[model samples]
Target: MFDKLTRTFSDVLRQVSGKSSISEKNIQDAVEEIKIALLEADVNLRVVRRFVNHTIEEARGEKVLRSVNPGQQFIKIVHDRMVNLLGSETEGLQLKGPDTLSPILFMGLQGSGKTTTCAKLALRLKKEGRKPLLVAADLVRPAAVKQLQLLGEQTGVPVFAVEGEKKPVKVVKQALSFAKKNSFNTMIVDTSGRMHLDDDLMKEIQEINSVLKPVEGLLVADAMTGQQAVEIAKEFNERVGITGVILSKFDSDTRGGAALSLKSVTKKPIKYVGVGEKIDELEQFHPDRMASRILGMGDVVSLVEKAQETIQEEEAEELQKKLQSSTFTLQDYLEQFTRIKKMGSLQSLVEMIPGMKGNIDEDALNSKEMKKEEAIILSMTLQERHNHRIIGPSRRKRIASGSGTSVFDVNRLLKKFDKMRLMMKKMTKNKKLQAQMLSQFNGNI
Candidate 1:
């Protein structure tokens, strides 16, 4: 998601990549470049100053000048500073009620996706085997209640709401009582959001806090807002108190300034990031992996975790077997697309990969193109899906017509799939070929 920042760091690293020694002049030049990059990405001036200063001090103190790979060493120093800015480490949610029901208060501004994030968090907790009840206390917005209800329904969690309790505190208190009666071990209170920070809003939230006594108070913010997101987090923390920050719309941010600045400005750990609109799109925020990503290195660990969470164990196992055996086919292709669709948008998936972040058309992946592709595949019969060779010109026309597409569209997918399968098959047969493929995949020269 941090395409601009990632590109900036990669370019800076490139300037030092092949150097055998670093001079003071060169280091100063690089630091100046970093300052501009950070500023361009909307990083706070104070943060940028500290970052460049720390990087220079560390670069000199570590004797990067004498190192054989001075450029790499310099980049490492910058990477470390970025990690510090983005929170030194990940933080876990608090569940401290005798291993029973624990209350968590969700707070944010309107249009911050607070309600969606609440359901995503509950789904995350449920994945960890924690039974969480979604309490829809945003009674101010009519659609808010319905949105939470749909999320709960999709995630198979219970949504607790009263018919006429207008006050958020009253709704939460009653929701908690209902949860306790139903044996729910965890209650997530989704509170209402306001257009701007106000005294009345703070009072209502404080009153809700007094009644529910939430162990965790999370502020959901849109990552696209950049430094404004961080400012919002600070204001919320100062007024209502927040335990952590949840960065939503992460899939849309290219500058990534918000993620880098929020934790440092607010002095709160980022617990999770919302990658997509799906309930399962929430990813636990990890500093080290995020650092790697900012350095233009792929996050393989997070990628695997995402796959495991989204794909069924048996299905993934089968895919692995097929990969090893060179049995990849159109059927396997369709299965992979389905799995990826469940995970999130294809553009977000591309961004998570090592070097394809800025190159992928995010809108295309998340748009009707993806749906069109799926429809084209689904229009094929079982035999056609398994064996692409059987789809003759007449059948191609029929399938295209059935799927509301042109023959060219179907041909494009098949051509790409064939090339990919052939390349994978060749790589499967030779370890060195596979390594070379991986190297090329990572954008190495």
Candidate 2:
């Protein structure tokens, strides 16, 4: 996600990395490259101009001129400005009260992933101890209600849909009654979307807003739409007063223009982002972390949160013990991969590791490789997994044939596993190394 923008920033920074001092000419050249990069990524022209101008003005300061490391100073200025452009702070949904119902109406265009995001939010809320009722108010699109209903079933949330109900307002009205009777604390209304932002769509959303008085009228914009997402957000905010944005397809947006420009254009923070298609992939947006990632700095906090959410404490403890003893088996190694898979895609997980953010090769961490590793491990016998030392060439050939791979592939995997065990042993004993690893996200190389 945002791979292009990150590469652009990293490239621009590299040109100035070893400079003794940042001259005006150096600043100009770097800013010009950044401007082109932003424009190429389809960032809003105004946002690009403001960001470049702010960065130039700040870089000319005496603090940077007299700094020991001018390159780090330049990085700080750009990181801060990017954070401001992306919304300086994180903002969550504005719910009415703890005891009252807060209806969140999702609005966007067709194919914007609004309905799926609605279910993601409902599932997140349910996990947080909120009884959420999914209201299928999107009556315009064919099977929109059924889509939301299926997602609700997958997420273990109740869906409020009236069969043959074509009126969105009426559906929401009955959903409200049902929610209140059943003691649901929140109602997520998957409102209708259009092929384009038409007057009828606006008016219908307005009616839903007026009737339900939704606590949050969120526009679910597709980040892959580039600058058009900014325009859509502006129109939505103008016509229907959307409180925030939920950027869908964020994980697939390589350019990152919409996520950067939407907050500035709409004057509304992005409350959440759809990181993947899974119901558990919607994440609360954090501006600082996002800024960090865009500048080739990793987001360790988000990474840690993802780990804690996916890995059980006891499981983590047992894994740590195994690693410390240098007794981690192939079974433990495969389990580690499984746990990491639960966190997210390998590409995304690599981006969270501090120094590894801009440095990971997509082909190297490809999901196909992950699947192959799993297959090889699964093909091994219990004895082979327990003690890899017992697997000689014949055992390796057997495992390779069983896993549909060659003998060389099995050898490569065993080599990697051996290196990993050594690294784990070192990490367990080396406090300074562990601290250095943990501090990788401080934004100073």
Please name the candidate that would achieve the greatest TM-score relative to the true structure.
2
Local distance difference test values of all predictions, in order:
0.83, 0.87
Cα TM-score of candidate 2: 0.95
Mind giving the per-residue lDDT tens digits that candidate 1 earns over 123-177?
9888788889999888877789989999999999999988777778878888888
Candidate 2: stretches off by over 4 Å = 438-445
TM-score (all chains, Cα) for each model: 0.90, 0.95
lDDT of 2 by residue, 1-445 (tens): 6787788888888778777788888888899998998888888899899999988898988877778989878878888898899899999888766688988888999999999999999999999888899998888888888898899899999999999877889998888888888888899999888899899999998898999988888999998898989999999999989889999999895688898888888899999999998889999999998888787777888988999987889988888888999889999888888788789988787777765766766688778887888899999999899999999999999999999999998999999999989998999989999888657546443
Where's the lowest-lDDT run of ten residues in candidate 2? 436-445
Which prediction has the highest lDDT against the true structure?
2
lDDT of residue 255 for candidate 1: 80
Candidate 1 Cα outliers beyond 4 Å, as residue runs:
312-317, 320-326, 359-375, 406-413, 436-445
